[model samples]
Target: MPKLRVVSYNVRGLKDDRAALGEVIRDLAPDVLFAQEAPRRFRWRHKCAELARSGGMLYASGGLPGLGNAILVSMRVTVEEAWGLRYPLTPGRHLRGAAFARCSVAKVPFLAVGTHLATDDTERPAQAALLAATIREAGGTTIFGGDINETEGGSAWRTLADTRTDAGATNQTPTFSVTNPSRRIDALFADKTCTVTSYSVIDTPAVRRASDHFPIYAEITL
Candidate 1:
């Protein structure tokens, strides 16, 4: 079995917090990384790709030119295909989307998703469903990491539980809002077919200082 290390981060780029994000990725050395809030700051600013390369990884991101998600993987992994999930305006912010990369690590196939959902109460459930649907469409039993901006006991959790083919909940940890640091807006969720051997919140302060949110990590085996 391959020891799959994954990370979910909301790097508040296109803003003041883009500086410290790269160091966090280097320190964690995750095999697969999913990032949100990758807004375009300039025409040539490839923050996501640059961060991935700095961490010795490859990256593919771009849905609506900017304001989407990104998936980064180490050189050891092979990415088959990747795309973004564009949600509707009712429950989505239109430009807000989830990015996916169908990848193989050590001969094991898994799908990675980078996502962000609307903060509105009614739209979040629909957005959650979209994520699960994306996972199912990817053939199930994959690793999902992102800044969901929802707590474990919220409606989004209930919605995900209903849509998931697997049996498990969020890590029940906190990851977000570094300025105050009290809620868990970031998370890692895996399919029922995957087994989570370990999980933790990364304490890379330099990384934390780069954005308003921190990163969540998990060690999964299948």
Candidate 2:
């Protein structure tokens, strides 16, 4: 089995240090980057392209329609199919969504999804359920990553954990409030068919300045 390095990050809509963020991502050298809070306004694609280029990657999927969710892949991966999905809006609440891609690394295929759930306690569960269904429909080996906004054992977290392997189960490193770090809201989940070899919370200086949430990195095999 080949090992793939995957990272999930919330870039805070590129509102922070872009150069620092790129450097952190480049240094991490992930095969697949599942990003949330990416640029979604005017020239969003251009911004995303520039970020990907800076990190030695190419845009895979998700941007505007995903409401900030996006995915970037290294040269080693070929994106076979990709699309963005918008979750049903809860009037007056922020729009949340997900990005999905079927990619091949050295001709071995798998599904990757990125999302950011709503902050509302009541709304996040439904979003999680929707995300879980999307993963189930992804077929083959699947991996999902995002800023879930809820802690372990929470409803939204439990919804996904019930059917998938929580990548951070072995390493409960905190990933929120970069400076004061006190929670593990950012996470990665993979289908049982895939093996999560290692998982870590990237809390380096660059990562702390890149966004409000520390990135989660995982080494997986299918």
In order, the Cα lDDT scores of the candidates are: 0.70, 0.88
| Residue pair clashes in candidate 1 | 166-192
Give the per-residue lDDT digits (tens) of candidate 1, residues 1-222.
787878887877536444466667877888888777765445424665676776666785543432467787877778887777777776334457688878887888877777788777678888888777767777845777666667766787666655343212435445767776788767677766777877787766686577777777777885
Off by over 4 Å in 2: none
List TM-scores for all candidates, in order.
Answer: 0.86, 0.97
lDDT of 1 at 189: 71
Model 2 lDDT per residue over 1-222, tens place? 767999999899888888889999999999999999988889999988888988888999988867899999998889999888888998999998999999888778899889999999999999989888877776778888999998997999999788689999978889888878898998898888889999888878888778888899999986
Report the Cα lDDT for residue 192, model 2: 85
Among the numbered candidates, top TM-score falls to: 2
